[model samples]
Target: MKPPSSQGLRLTCLLLALASLCLPIPLWKDRDSLMQEEKAQETGGNLVLSRQEQQLNTKLVSLKKMEIATAMTTGQFPPSMHFFRAKRLIDQSKVFNIIKLMPKGAVLHLHDYAMLSVGWLVYNATYLPDCYICFTHTGTVRFRFSKPHPPHPVPAQCSQWVLLESYRKQLHNVSEFDRSLVRNLTLVTDAPEQAYPSQTFIWKRFEEVFLIASGLICYAPVFKAYFYQGLLEFYEDNVQYVEIRAILPTVYELDGTQHNKSWSVAIYQEVTRQFVKEHPDFLGAKIIFTAHRMLNVSQIKEAIVTAMALRAQFPDTLAGFDLVGDEDEGHSLWDLKDALTIPYSLGVNLPYFFHAGETGSLLQGLLLVLHGHFHLGAVLTSHPLQQQNFSAIILHFKVKQCLSQPQVLTADTHQSN
Candidate 1:
C-alpha cells in the first residue's frame, strides 16, 4: 500500500478528533489538564510547540480519542486492531494497559534466516556475494553463486563505502532497494500501485541468501558462529529465548563422508546448549525437528525417528516436531498421520506444530480436521480464532496458536517465527 500523504494524515487526524467524543466522560474529564502539563514539560518556558511536534501531538490525541470512542461503542476491539491502533497512540495515555491486554507470549514458527534484519546480514556479516549468480531472468528464491575459490583481494572501495553495520549503530536506518535483481526475484509486483516497496521487498532477497547460509551453517564452526550471531540479533529485539527451526541441508563432509541429518541435529543440540550458557539473558532455546513437506513417506518416517532420538537425547531442548515448507503443492499432514503417530509411541512427546493451513485449501482442511478428527492439543493457523479455546500470535506474514502458551522459553515466540 502507498504511504499516506500529508493531506490524508491531516484528514485522519480530524476524524480521530471527532471520534474522541465517544470516549467515556471519565477518561476525558482530566485529559485536558494532563495534556497541558505534558505540553509545558515538553516546551519548557514557551507554550508554542514546534510545527512537527505539534502535528505529532495532535495526531496522538486524535488517535487515543478514536480508540476510546471505539472501545466504548464496540465493547472491545479485535486484538490485532488494538495492537495497530496502540502503536499509533504515542502519548502513553494507556500504552501499558494495552500491552497487558494483548497475548504475545510465544512465537513458534519463524524461519531463522528471515528473523534477522537484513542490514545486520549485509553490514555485520559482510554477506555481499563476491560473484553474482541468477537462477533465471524472472522470479526465483534460490540461486547458485560462484564459490570464492580464489577469494577476491580486499577491494579498495571497502575503505570508502558506507558500511551497513556502522549505519545501523549510528543512524538505525536501512536503505530500501531501488531496483531488484529480477522483475520478480526479490519481488513479485502485479500492479503499478505496488511498485514502490520497503524492507518487505528486501525480505525476498533475504530468503535467497538463506540457501547460501544453510550450506555455510553445515560446517561445525560456521554453524556455531551463525548461531551465535542469530542469538545476539534476537536478543537485540528484546526476545529472551528462541527455538530455531534448523534443517541441516544434505551435504558431503570434507573427508567425503556424508554428514546426514541426524549427525547435524546432534551437533546443533550441543552448540545450542553451549550458546545458551554463554548468554545469561537467554532463559533457554530448543529445536522443533522439522521435516520438509516435499519429502516422501519413508523420508518423513526417518525424519520423525531422527527427531524422536534427538528428543530422548536432549529432552529439554528438543521440544517437538514440525513439517516445514510450502504446503500448497504437497501432501497434507493428515496424509502422513500414521507415520506421525510413531514418534509418540516411541516416548517422544513430539507434539506436532505442523504448518497446516498455510494455503487457502490447506488451512480450511486442517481447521476442519483439527476440529473433528483429533482434539488438537493446540493448533497454529493463519486465520483468527472464532472461539476462546485458542490463543495465538500473528507474525508479519504468518500466525501461530497452541492449546496453551507452549512452555514459555523466556523469548518471544513471535521472534522465533
Candidate 2:
C-alpha cells in the first residue's frame, strides 16, 4: 500500500473535524434538574383531576403557602421544622384543630401503650380503687392493681409498692400528683430535643414509660377499658381504623389472679368488637402482636407460638405479628429467622410486620426484607438511605413471582430525624 501525502493527511484530519461538528452531542442533567424532572413526571401523570379534587388540592396548597408565609413573617416555628417542634407550634397556633377534623384513613403504627394520653392513664386508670405504684431505683415507675391495702413488704425487690390511693390522700392536692404521674408516663417536655439528647436516650425513656403503663394496662379489668378508651381517642381524631402493636404480656386481675395470654387476647377482641359495635362510624381495630427484639431466640419462638395460637382464636381481629424495640440496640430480624418462619412452615397465615432499618442502615433493612422473605409486611424508618434502598428493593423484587401478592410497606417518619 502507498503512504498518503502530507496534504492528503491534512484533508483527512479536516474532514474528521467537520464530521465531529455535525454529530449530535449527548446532554446530561444536573442533580437538581433530574430531581425537578422526576417531580414533574410524578405530578404530570395525574393531570386529569376531577373538579372537586382540583378545588381541594388548590385549597390545600393555598393553606400550606399561607402557613409558610405566616411562619416566615412572624418568625414562628414552621411546619417544615422537626415534628416535635412543629407539633408544639401547631398546638399553640390551634392549627392542629384543622388537622384533627381531617379524616385519617387508618392509623397503622401506634404503640398500644403510648396511644392514650398520659393524663388519662394517671388520672383515670391509676385512680381506680385498687391501683398501686412502685418507684424503682433506676427512676422507672411501675404500676399494679392489687387489693386495697398498705404498701406490700418486699424489701428484697424494693422498699414497698405503695397504693396510689394512699399517695393521693397524703398529697394535699391529688391533681398535682396526677400531673406528676403524667410527667413520668410521657415524653412531652418544653424542650424534647434537649431532654432527650439522642435516639438512644429518648428510646430508653420511651421503653420506661411503656413499662410504667404496662403494669397498669396489663391488669385484666383495665385492659378492656383502656383499649376502648384508646379507640375512642383515635375516633375523636377522625381515625376510623387502627392497628395497634402490643406486647400482650400476661394480664393480672385486681385480686392478683393472673390471666393467660389467650384470655388477654380474648379481652382485646371483645373490647374492640364492642367499641366497633357502639361506634358504627368507626371501621374497626386490629391487634398486631409484638415481641420484644431484646428477647432471646427461645423467648421469640415462644412468642411466635403464642401469637399463632391467638391468630387461630381471633383471625378477624388479629392483624399480624411484629418485632418491636429500638432497632439499633436489639437483635436483628435475621437472628430469629427460625422462629419467624415457624408460622409459614406450620401452614399458618400470620404475616410478618418487622421493624427494619429504624436505626439508619438501609442495607440492614434490605437484608431483612430479601433474606427473611418478609413479603407480607415491613416497617422501615424514612431515612434517606432507607428510602433509597427501599426503592431499589421494590424494583429488585417486583418481578419475582413469589412476591406477586400485594405487600404492606410502611415508613416510620417518627424516627427520620
Candidate 3:
C-alpha cells in the first residue's frame, strides 16, 4: 500500500491541492470586526444567550429606555447629578430596584478604608473605650484612641482632646450627636453644589474625611473590627469576593504600640481567614497593596519592592500593586514610568492595577494609555472621564480590566449620580 506508483501519488496530491483551494480561507478583511465581536463576548456581551435570557435582556433594555424617558422628562435621577443627591430618586426607579435585588459577584474596586458607612464608624469605633475627639481650626472633626494624658502629642488641628465616652454622656440626645459626627465625616449634605463648589475643594475635603476617619480605624481593636465589618458589609450586598486597594494604615494600640506594614498585611490575612472560616459562601478577598500616586518615583519604586516582598510572604492575600490617588492632582502615569516599569524589568509577574485615566480629561486619559504600554498590566480607567479610549488601551496594551476607580476611598459623591 505504501509503495504506490509516483504517477498515482502526483494525481492524488493534485486533487488534494484543488480541494484545499476550494475549501475556504479566512477573510483577513473582517479580522478586526470579528475580533471585536469575540472581545464583546469576553466582556459580558453574552453571545450564546438562551432564548429566555435574551427575552429578559430585551425586557431590561425596554425598562432602561422607559426609565431614561421618565428621567429626561422629570429631570430626576440625572446621571450628572450627585448619587447622594439623587439617591432618593434612584430608589424610585424600578430598574434600580431590580438591579439592587440582583446578587453581585465581587466588588472589583473598593478602598478598604472607606467601605463602611460613617454611621457604622460612629456606632462601632466612637463608642470604644479610651477614644478621644476634637474639632479642627476649621469646623472639620478629628478622632484619636490614645490616652487623654500629655504623652501622645496631640495634632495642632485638634486643640484639646476630650474623652468621647464622657462627651457622649454629656449630650442630652446622643443619637443627634452621633448624627452630627457622621455629617462631619461624610460629604452627605442637603446641597452638594454649595458644599463642594469645585472639584479641587471636594478632593481636598475627601482627603480630610479620610484623615478624620483614620484615627478610629488605626486603633488596633478597631482596625480588626473595621476589616471584619467591611467584609460583612460586602457579604450582605451579595458580594462573594472583593479586591481592595488600600495604603495599609499604621495600626496602633491605646498604649501607643504601633505595628509595621508587614504586621498590617498579616492582620489582613488573619482577618480574612477568620471571615472565610465563618462564612464559606463568601469566596474571599484580596488586597492590591497601594502607594499614593503623589509619591516620588524612588518612593514608589521602594513601595513596589516592598510590595514584591510582601507578596512573597503573603501570596494569597497580597493580590498585586497599584498607584492610588486623585488622578488630576497626583503624578501622571507618564511621570511614574520609571517606577512602574520596575516590575517588568525585574521579570516579576506581579500584576499592576493602577488607577489610570481617572482624571476628567479624555486627552489625558489617552496619553496615560501611551505610557502604560511599556508595562503589561491593567489600567483602572474611570469611564468617560477623559477615558473614552479604553478599547484603544485594551487593543494596544493587551490589558485585563475591572472597574476600580477607588470610590470608597472618600466621599466623592459629586461625580456620581
Looking at model 3, residue 19 earns an lDDT score of 76
Work out the TM-score per prediction. Answer: 0.50, 0.75, 0.75
- Of the two candidates 2 and 3, the one with more favorable lDDT, higher being better, is 3
Candidate 2's TM-score reads 0.75
lDDT of 1 by residue, 251-364 (tens): 443233456666666666666667668876565566667777778888898888887777777767666677765455556776766666675455435555554544433464
RMSD of each: 17.4, 8.4, 12.2
Q: Model 1, stretches more than 4 Å misplaced?
A: 1-105, 124-213, 216-220, 251-258, 345-348, 360-417
Winning model by lDDT? 3
lDDT of 3 at 20: 76
Clashing pairs in model 1?
A: 106-413, 107-413, 107-414, 109-417, 110-417, 241-411, 357-363, 378-403
Displacement of residue 117 (Cα, Å) in model 1 is 1.9
Output the number of the TM-score-best candidate.
Answer: 2
User: Considering summed lDDT, which 10 consecutive residues are worst modelled in model 2?
Assistant: 402-411
**Model 1, residue 15: displacement in angstroms?**
44
lDDT per residue (tens digit) for residues 1-417 in model 2: 999999999999999997777553322336567777777688355377799978876877777687778888977643334444455677755445666888976766667787786677777888788877777786557787777453356433444788777777888887776777888887766775577766667777878777778887888777888888999999999998887888878788766678787787788788888998999999888788899989989999999998888888888877678888776678777777767778766766676555454443336545756764544333334234324333433443322221111111111222222
